[model samples]
Target chain A: MKQIFRTIAMIFVLCLAASPSFSQTGKTETYPPIDSDALEQFGGPEGVRNWVESLFYYIMLDNRINHVFREFGNIERQIYLNTQLLQLVLGGNEVEYQGASMAAAHADLGITLTQFNAVVEAAYNACERIQLTYEACNLMIAGLAPYKHAIVTR
Target chain B: MEEAKRAKFPVSKGAALVVAMLASGLSQAGWYDSGKVLATGGVSMIDGAGGGGITPWATITGYGTKEGINGDLHYTYAPLANYTLHSLGAAVGFWDRFELSYTSSALTTGSTFDTVGLVADTLGGVTGSLAGTPINTGIEPFNTTIEMESIGAKVRVFGEAIYDSDNLIPQIAIGGFYKNNKNEDLLKTLKADKAKDWEAYISATKIFFPINTLINITARYTAANQTGLVGFGGPDGSDKEIRPEISLAYLLRKDTVIGIEWAQHGDNLEGESVEIAGLDLTGLQPTLEALGLGNVSGTLTQHESDWYDVFVAFFPNKNLSITMAYAMLGNITITPDQHGFYMSLQASF
Candidate 1:
């Protein structure tokens, strides 16, 4: 019917309108452009540190991916570096991430898709626990999504 | 900020305690692991498949990861203007790759038998009067519940519908369902060729994270009449034909989605003349026509229509999901524009 087609067309247009806002930060060689509002809600690098710590806390408790985390030598250093990387991901220049490239760092882990999904779930839970806005959490996940190919070897 | 940190300190300590337990070998890994993401296991479909209300998708039916198993039970009900449909089923997902399901559906035909009896009585009266004899052709009311059972299986051939958001390739799967209608005598009276048949379909599903949209397309090959509730094939031994079904959904968040689905059906039973029990209408047509009562041949030709719905699904957690929809099932049997509200409840583990 004409009404059904019109409704479908309207939804398609809305999807198109929302595409650019979520995809603008794709595949950047360096840190993405800072979103000042998101950074303010994050309460700067201190807030970023708290969120990373919360994320690692959940990661260590998750049986699916916790064993992989146990293989790391220094849990505190891993948390510190992840906080710096997350800060850069949110467009903050407060710290530089000194860890290896995502592919190289994860190459030896033999992580499966299941484990990667578990990690993503944990990250989302951490964002929620930190009381981040819904859009901010989605934007953060979108920024990190491209690395799945590199991190998930199987 | 200080208060927040203080509140989270116990959580941090608990994590450390759990890690210490793991270090001391005090924990045993559980057998079942619901590691898949939320809402990734889609809601249970009407036919017990894991998909939208009517069209099946490529995703498996539960929250299990590749290393474990998961299953769920679902109940769906639709109350249309002329009839009501009830479906109940269960499904199991194996290693997140293969799925098996069973569903039993019943359709209650309201006011259909009375209308048939009224037509039969009038024809009998006219023909008997012309022949100088009184005849009775009234049919007794019978059980009007048409029941069908479906057993289905699906295997994921390739691709991933979720978690591979970096690519454009969608998940693809192939599946089939064997259906059996329980009303054998009624099917014979209705001039159907068979009471059971097979329906096979291949589905492709993809989620575009950038737009927060999910799309599923399926091509089904079947000879079923109104999804086999009325029976299968026609009086002419109808061959299986291909039809298309599609579902498009937009994610409001990770746990909720609003969507639309359209499923096309076949017309295998259309234009077929029917034979009512204890009535030979072919012999009475001439007598009725001679009395100027018009031709009284029982030409029971019914047309079927495509089914579509607009739905919203919400998953409060990984264990339970609820879906509500406005369904449009046009021209079912003798009824026109059979539209109504549909609701389904699913519990997954």
Candidate 2:
């Protein structure tokens, strides 16, 4: 049994050592460039600001993730940044996100998967409450999907 | 007694480390010493630290990591008709980079020892002889408690399982466990590996944030057959096999999750002939047949069953959580169609 196990381990180690293709795991994913039409569907800059407020409202009440924002009062800047970021990502040239990158913004916050997922969930729920068309909501979520890696630092 | 004390030294050290981390962590507060997001650190697995029932994943076990430290303690119970398993576990995660964990399990095997003729083995008789009657080792009616301990460590190598919404790069982690069981003498007669064994694994996890879906895959390689449940090694030789496990979870709420976990295992105890744990049943076949029991062909040694558990985990707060799962044990080797329920309570910081 020991000999057989050794042989198997040897094969495994060799496979890992010899397989260069296995190193492709750390690369980032890319999505198609956002178009202006989808941004319009997400409801322009003012609509996005309202949507941000709605999402944060849900986030404040969410038990799973509310603790993270307990001390982060005064989210006016956050709202502004999010609105501009959403507009820019949705193919609108009306606003530009001038804040730090997502990774930098959340690096010290030590965001967790559950918190991240809650944020996404709240965003979706807010979209629902806003009565955006189902397709448009789906599009909005897809548009925000790519920022998870950057926003989640922990 | 001295050896036992010596054996506990490392665990004590680990505990001390946890205490020290906690002490220092308490000095600075208000930023949420728990560090990472709430409920992001999953509850513990049966034999290791991770999500799912039997499989471990790349994610660490707490909300800390990126900033602080995470610690948790858990207890689990699983009961079947012939067996009951009770386990206790503890884990500590630092910076989300590394984790150290320990788990101990006590399993009561009912009416199994007597049927296997432990008395005969103790009295220097043949492998299965008690008062001149060949003991039916395959089917038993005696109960005995078996104890096993496992210590594990894991580290996340690169990438992340969650939060990397745009990254195809799945979170990967490397981990291993050292397990020791007290049933050494009987296992020795069966040509098993040893009283202790090691298993190594690599896991990858990915979370697609938009869909709120998390998928995890893990591959493990080990020589301990049946996860060392039916004993390890066999007469035919024990070979390590790479087993794969997959887990999928849906976020019903931010704090509530329901998931399905499936883990594949290998059988390494087929051995040669009808030797049931070194007690060859060939000699008793005719005798049993004459008694109207038919030739009890003892070919039940190689039964390895995959474990499937559908679990629901709810975390009302970051520090407290509970998991309830229904596990399908498939084939229990000595028994047939053994399934059971599992519930675990976990507290984390």
Give the alpha-carbon lDDT of every model.
Answer: 0.74, 0.67
Worst 10 residues of 1 chain B by lDDT: B19-28
What are the per-residue Cα lDDT tens digits for candidate 2 across B1-349?
7336535557546546655665564565642346454556878888758666688889887667565667788888989766788888777776788887878787877764453444333322543354455433332335566677777789887666654444366788888877777766545534465556668888888766445567889998887755675565666566667889999987666577889999887666543323444455455566445544343345323355788889999988888889999888776645656688899888886
Q: Is the docking of candidate 2 incorrect, acceptable, medium or high quality?
A: incorrect
**Could you give candidate 1's per-residue lDDT for residues B216-327 as a string of tens digits?**
9999998888878778787668688899999999888778899999999878666554455445445555744675534434434466888999999999999899999999
List chain B TM-scores, each candidate: 0.81, 0.83
Q: Score residue B148 of candidate 1 by CA lDDT.
A: 81
- lDDT of model 1, residue B72: 79
**Most accurate candidate by lDDT:** 1
lDDT, residue B164, candidate 1: 47
